[model samples]
Target: MSRKTDPLIVRRLRGEERVLEVGIGDRTGVAARLVDAGIDVRATDVRPVAAPEGVRFRVEDVTAVDEPDAFHRVDTVYALNCPAELHRPIRDLAAAVGATFRFTTLGYEAPSIPVERETLGGGDTPRLTLYTATTRDGTPRGSR
Candidate 1:
């Protein structure tokens, strides 16, 4: 994805609030882009990885996260191209922290969390599809 598109996607997922990028692999490009755009964001994964300057990094396994405050600091949680198996855990984590969840799945795979669909870009621009999970009250977070 282009650097310009990265921030747009983050904004679409998180609006202007702090976001936690879960399952961030070796690449911190998205996190870096968000930081450059003046958004408060962090990246995490099951294994340790180096983050770009101004971006925070943490080692977290969503499937086994037991910390009560695991995601309390962020307003939204998201992962790009997240695996199908991690969707439920991510949703639970978001709920635990009272934050919203968002993710993009590989290909045509659907998200495990109930979501509202959004499409970014048009015509000449590459279109990206994202799923934004709702709170238990059924309000779409970040849409506000």
Candidate 2:
């Protein structure tokens, strides 16, 4: 299935030079596309997986990130179709590193992180929801 939200995710990261994609799984197409567009991107998952050419891969778990400087290395953190249980940990990781958090959830589920939602794709394409993390002050954390 095609990911309709890819464009929107790339758009939201327009000026960001680098980003870390969490829970990359076995697919690296998105990461490859972003890299082709001149954005520096890296991917991480709980288990090691093969990645597209030029896309760096690492093993990481959002729920149990032990690397003290894990989040500090990137300007943004994102996960596509992540589970609800991981929402808060990703948000916390972003906050702790002062990076932006963005993610898409599985359809029929709600996000656990506070976010501003945007819809992408039309017609038969499954409606995709893109979420951007917000600060406690009710503002997009990455706006600055």
**Which candidate number would show the highest lDDT if scored against the true structure?**
2
Question: Lowest-lDDT window of 10 residues in candidate 2?
Answer: 1-10
TM-score, prediction 2: 0.85
lDDT of 1: 0.75
Worst 10 residues of 1 by lDDT: 1-10
Error of 1 at 31 (Å): 0.6
How displaced is residue 89 in candidate 2, in Å? Answer: 0.8
> In model 2, what are the clashing residue pairs, if there are any?
none
Instruction: Kindly report which residue pairs in candidate 1 clash with one another.
Output: none
> Where does model 2 exceed 4 Å of error?
70-72, 123-126
> Cα deviation of 127 in candidate 1 (Å)?
0.9
Q: How many backbone clashes does candidate 2 have?
A: 0
What's the TM-score of each model vs. the native?
A: 0.84, 0.85
